[model samples]
Every structure is written in C-alpha cells, then in structure tokens.
Target: MSGPPTASEDAPIRVLLADDHDLVRTGFRAILGVEPGVEVVGEARDGDEAVQQAQRLEPDVVLMDVQMPGVDGLEATRRILGPSSPTSEVRVVILTTFDREDYLFEALQAGASGFLLKNASADDLVEAVRIAARGDALLSPEVTRRVIARFSTPGPAVQPRRPPELTDREFEVLVLLARGATNAEIAGELYLGETTVKTHVSRVLMKLGLRDRTQAVIYAYENGVVAPNGPSRDGSET
Candidate 1:
C-alpha cells in the first residue's frame, strides 16, 4: 500500500473547502490564502458538491462541515475515503462547533483525519490542514479525552471482533498510540528510532484495517487491546 504524500517544502498543500455557508467558506479561503504552503483549490457549497469536487480535483485535504443541507459531511467523508473511490487517498478534516461525542465517533468512523472546532484560530486551521495533508490525524486533546471515554466503556460479554495479528513490538507501539503519544514520543518511550516507530505505526494501521491513528486509537479501546487503567496487549500497564 502507498503511504501519505511526503511533500517537499516548496510544494503547497492543495485544499478544498466544503461548507453550506458562503461567508464561512469565504472566510476560510481568506485565512488559508495567506498561509505560505497552503492553497484553496476548490469550494463546495454542500456535501454532494464536496464529493463531486473531491473526485474531480483530488485535493490533498478537504475541510468538511459536519452539518450540511443534505448528504451531510459524515457520509461524504465515507464516500471520499472509501476504498471504491478513485480519490480515496484524500484526507478529510471535519469542522463543527459542537463537541458532541456522537459526531466525534461518527466522524472518526467515517475516516476523517482531523476534527476542528469552528472557533479555532487561523493558525490552528492552517496547521490542521497541513497535518492532514501529511496523512496525520489532528485530534485536539479535548477530543482525545472523548475518544478514550467513548471506547473505554464496558460492553457486551461477547467480544466485538477478534484482534488483528500484530508483532509484539507493533502491539507496544499501539499501546502508546492509544495513550495519545506522538511518533517521536513513542520512539523515545520505546527506545527506538522515530523512523522505525513510524514503520511500526504504518504496519499497525494496515493490519488493523484502520484509516489512521485516530481509528487505531478507537480500535485499541473497543477490541480490548488497551483499556482504561488496564494492561496493554503485552500484559503491562501503559
């Protein structure tokens, strides 16, 4: 499988703005226009238009509003990132004002790489776009806490799904990931090189059939790979 784009310093990140309100879209365009390595390539007034433009333009990142008139951003994100789509590599960043858990869960399940509040600053927005463009999940600490809580709840007696087969080291990497550790942090904690940690991360994502680290974090909790105040896959507390 191919990895995310490793863009050079000179290559600007292509972005597609998708929101129902024209003024909101315009404001976002204006903010992004001034960033050095970001360019708004297209605009979509609704979810349907977002999907169409994403397919046609294949931008590196899509700023999608969760609540649109029809089709909604959640479904549009799934369609754009689903395996059947031609531009499935496109990364989606869900934009919303509400901090509801349902939207957060749905967005992550739909394969969104980032979740940003509407009231975020211009710098946060630009950084989130660049992060998504580089194929990383941009979950704020607040959202991370929600993720932990949502997936850490007690469930039915029966197991949800069998755990994927992963190497011992990869399993350790996943534990740190579920604890919200970044690549460099994971490397330091594991006493491994950052590049090696990144490889293990990629392998873990591939093996789990997940879209990105955010989904992997969810998977770690839901499948009992890691638990709140519980031992990790290697039978050790994280």
Candidate 2:
C-alpha cells in the first residue's frame, strides 16, 4: 500500500513531517503526496511544534526526524509517548540519517516503534508509516541486520528472557503480534490457522497480563523475550 488507508479515494493518509530543515520537510511532503493514499497533513520545524501540532491535528502518523532544534528527536519522542501522550495512539517513526547507537537506543527506549534513514526510498517510507499505523514496530523491517546484531550482545547474553508462563508457540505469537503482525499475518508466519492464532494471541495476552498487542510488544522488548531486531513482517507475510 502507498500509505495508511484513507477515509476515501479522495481522502489521504494524514501525516505530519517533523524536521528542523525546511527542505527536508518539503521533500518528504512531495514524495509522500505523489504516492496514492498518502497525504502530508502538516509540517513542523521542531519537536515542540511537532508535539503541539500532534495535539491539534492528531494525524495518523508522525514521520519524525531525530535531530531538531529545542527538543531533539529523543526527548520529543519521550514527551509525546509519555504516560500523558495523547490517547489517539499516534505512532512515531524516526526518520534520520544518523546510525548513531545512542540515538537508536534512545529512540527505542522513548517508545518509537520504527526507524528509517533520511535517504529511505519513497516506497519504504510509505510502508514504514503504514505499518506503524497498525501499531507494529517498523524497526526490524527497515533497519539493517547490523543494527539488530549490535543489540544482540554476547557478554553472558542478558537480553530480556522469555516469560516463564508463556509456552513456545505462545511466545512465537507474542513476537509476531508485538512486531505488529495481524492475526492472519501471524497465522501465515507460524503455520497456524487464523482462528488458532487468535486463540493463542488471546491466551498469550491473558497469560502475560497485557491489555493488548502493543503492550505485549513493549513487554517483549523490556523483558528481552524477543530481540528488538528479530525476523518480522516487513509486508513479507500477508
């Protein structure tokens, strides 16, 4: 898909581009606008404005650049994603050129669900956003394996461990679910029927004491049940 589903053909996937550079926002708007189902709803020059506009417009997604004046991407991400973050569930994807480890970790900790380079292709941008809108982390799909590997440290291997209560199959579903894979997507990936997948997801959610799939994903990371960079649907599975 070009972007998140719009209300109608004439409608568009509402998007907000948050970056410090004028040219950067302009280029993003142009690329996203040309793609079907996508529209640049608004643009912000800094993180403060980004948060303000997010409060006002409540767009479907925020294509946020990591480095900006006043509030940098990391802090902005934290503020917007804070406990008081808008109830609209607006997803934030970091669109930055820096592969700096510090920013990467911070963004993840701050609750950003996806990360992409400034030079990301128009198609990738569109999909990244579309997937994020579904409440899945876009990190594994877009970031390189090197980035994933970096987090897979071996000093005693202390990544979050799988929850003791979850069965193997339940754990698998949890990963896919947290990664934003739909029930059908999880069924295809795990070789189960959609109905079966739903049962497993429901059971997993209950067992994990989670409110929903989004919390499952955050728990998966915080507990190291799945590495932040694990095999996931980048639209690879239906």
Candidate 3:
C-alpha cells in the first residue's frame, strides 16, 4: 500500500482538531488559525466524531485530546492511523492536559506522531503540527527524557540480538533514532549526507514494519536491540 501523501513545500498543512471541550478546541483553532502554513480543516467534539471527520476530511495532522466522552483519543487515533485504515498516513498528535506516562506510551503505541500537553505554548503547538506534517515524530524534551529514563533503568541482563532482517547500517540508524538523534545529527555522527541518512531511516522503518521513529525507539528497547544506558554516539552511556 502507498504511504500517506506528503504535502508539497508550498501547500498549507491541513489540520483537524479533536477535543471534547468547546473551549479547548476553540483555543487550538485560534492558535493554529492564524499560522501561515496551517489550516484548521475541521473539528470533532468526541472520539467518534473525530474518527468520522478524519475519514471524511483526511487532514494531514490531527490534534487529538485523550479524554473524549466515548471511544477516547487513543482508540480514535488507532482507528484513524492503524494499518487497516486507508487514511493511515494521517498523523495524529495527542494533546492532553494530563502529563501521565501511561497516556504518553499509549498514544505512541496507537500510532500518534506526537504528544503535547495542553499547557504547551502557542509556538510549541504550531511547531508540533508542522513537525508531524513533515513526517517527523515530535516529543518534547521533558517527554523524551522520561521515555529514555524508562528504558535506561537497569533490567535483567540479556544478550542483545540484532534482527536478521536489518543491514548493519540499518541497525546503527535504529540505535541513533532510539537515542533521540535527529536525521541531521545522525548524518553528522555517521559522516553521511542528510539525504543518505533519511534513506537509511526510511529503510529501517520499512524493514521493521514500524509506523515511524517513535515506534522504532520502543521496538529497539523492547526487543533488546539496544539496552538501556547503552553506549552513546560519543561512546559514553546515554
């Protein structure tokens, strides 16, 4: 199947707002409404509506709230972005007032491309939409630190096994991705051009059947491809 369609550099990013609260949706619409490259295409007051609107509108980015009355944002996200959906390419960014770890992990597992607290500034919200629209995973520094810490805690020692499907270079790319290294950073570390790094990243995701880099990070840790507190690019424990 074809992947999600990429927006042209000059095309405005189409966005959908999914929040139960009218005020919250209004606030988001206001924030994104004035942004030059972002367009608020639709709104959903509940999870069911979110799914319906997502299918109908096919927005490039969905700003989803986790605590809707029914279905909830996580399940709505799954329905919208899961492999079965024709609109799976549509990116969902979980927006919540809660800073709970469970919500963060659940959102990622549901194929959300980003997660942001409602308290985040207007600039952060705008950037989150832009980042997800560009097909990059978005996690705030605080959230990233939490994710790394979760995996970095010492666990029972087990021998690391590289998946046979990946080339050695692909494995290296996965490690850097799990370390929260951006494509540019990976390029610098590996002495490759940015375009080459992007190709490796795409291959890594394709081979692993991952939706995006966020899943790659979880897969690397869960499968023991890279251990917690593993060697960093600088050869020090991360």
Candidate 4:
C-alpha cells in the first residue's frame, strides 16, 4: 500500500521511495500498505541515494521527488535511465508537490516513465506505476493537455484538420488514447469492446507513425488534439 515492494512480490513490482523527508516517506508507506498490490522496497533521503538504491534494489518503480538536496531528482533520473550499466530496467516516476509544465517536460525528457503530482490519489499513484512498469508512459490528462498547449504549432501541425485517412471512430479513439486512457477504460467510456478498442488503438498508432501510446500522446499534444485547461479525462485529473 505504501509503495512498490522492497523485494520481489507475487505482483512482481518492486518499488523504491525517494524523498528528502522521513515523515513523507512514512506517510507514503502507510498509504501504500492498504493496496492489494504494490509494496515499499526501500527508501532514500536524497537524489544520489535514490539513484544508488535504484541500482542496488533494482526496483521496478522509483517514486522520485524533485527539489532534493545533492544531484536533484531530474538529474538522478537521467543517471538511472541514461546510457548506463544498470542490469535491471529501473523505471522512474517523478512524484512532486509542484504541477509545473516545465517539470513535466523535463521529467519526460530525462527518461522518466511517468510524472505524478504529489496530490495524486492512491489509486492514481498505483495505476501510474503499473502503467509505467508495463512500459507505457503515464500521463495525466491535464499533463497531456499542457504538453499540447505549450508545444502545439497550430496551422502547420493542423492545417488540414488532420489527414483524411483516419476514420471518425478511429480519430475519437486516438484522442482518448492520447489523453492517457487505457484500452479497458476507453472501451468502458466509449461503450466498445476491449478488443475493438485495442484495434482502434493499434490503428491509431500505426496510422500516426507512432511507436507507442506515449509517443502518440506526445504527438496528439504537440499537434493540438488536446489543450491546456481543457476537460480532463483519462483518470488523471487533479
């Protein structure tokens, strides 16, 4: 309930907590304990220790906080995920008090698999780790919209209102998909079968020349599909 596991779990997600405050880590541990899945593998007082623990513990997820003492969270993230010799894939999820758009972009650029506001619900933190562990980027709808609004190029990117190739349903699915909704969630929202939603997702990815949902989300954002302050979907609102 408090975090990912210190050791291996039946759920197979080991988690490490990195924050400057001991009380914050304890609170996170208490909150994460009630969850059926997830466990707290270890804790670190700063970014450097976080990186070292990440290497040693090799947790499936690292809940990292920004603005730490030496080495800072973003730099630590870069070190962990950068071209290095870590045997395990140490997925990092930036969890911070701030909700700055710059932090979001910088975290993503630093090889973070996910970014979560510190105010995120327990459910969201859990789901974000799960999604990132599954190799998908975890973007909140608000985060996604901000990525769009801050980076969109307008006419050149949307002159023709998107290519005529995508079907209406496909386009709708793409928008939702890019908004960070999982296939199951999107299916429920759209009243479609999971398999059908998967098909639409796949088609959108292929047609848009995207490598995966994360890139597709970035594409949609940078192309004006979603805007900052727009309605939030994808179970990722504040």
Give the TM-score comparing model 4 with the true structure, all chains together. 0.67
Best by TM-score: 1
Q: Candidate 3: lDDT of 41?
A: 98
Cα lDDT listed for each candidate: 0.85, 0.71, 0.84, 0.71
Clashes of each: 0, 2, 0, 12
Q: Write model 1 residue lDDT over 1-238, tens digit each, in one string.
A: 6765544578889999999999999999999999898999999988999999999988999999988998899989989988888878898999987556788789888888878889999999998898898888886677778888776677664243335588778888888888999898999999999999999999998887787898888887777777777666567885
Expressed as tens digits, the lDDT of each residue in 1-238 for candidate 3 is: 3444656689899999999999988999999999998999999999899999999998999999998897999889989987878778998999876557788888888888878878999999998898888888885556666777777777876556687888878888888888788888999999999999999998888888887788888887777777667664334454
Where does candidate 1 clash, by residue pair?
A: none
Candidate 4 lDDT, tens digit per residue, 92-147? 88886555667777877666767777888878877877776665666666666566
Q: What C-alpha root-mean-square deviation, in Å, does candidate 1 show against the real structure?
A: 1.9
RMSD of 2: 6.6
By the lDDT metric, which is better: model 3 or model 4?
Answer: 3
Encode model 2's per-residue lDDT on 14-112: one tens digit a residue.
888999999988888888888887778899988988888888887878888888889877777788777566723567888866558778767766767
Model 1 spans with C-alpha error above 4 angstroms: 6-9, 158-164
State the displacement of the C-alpha of residue 57, model 4, in Å, after optimal TM-score superposition.
0.8
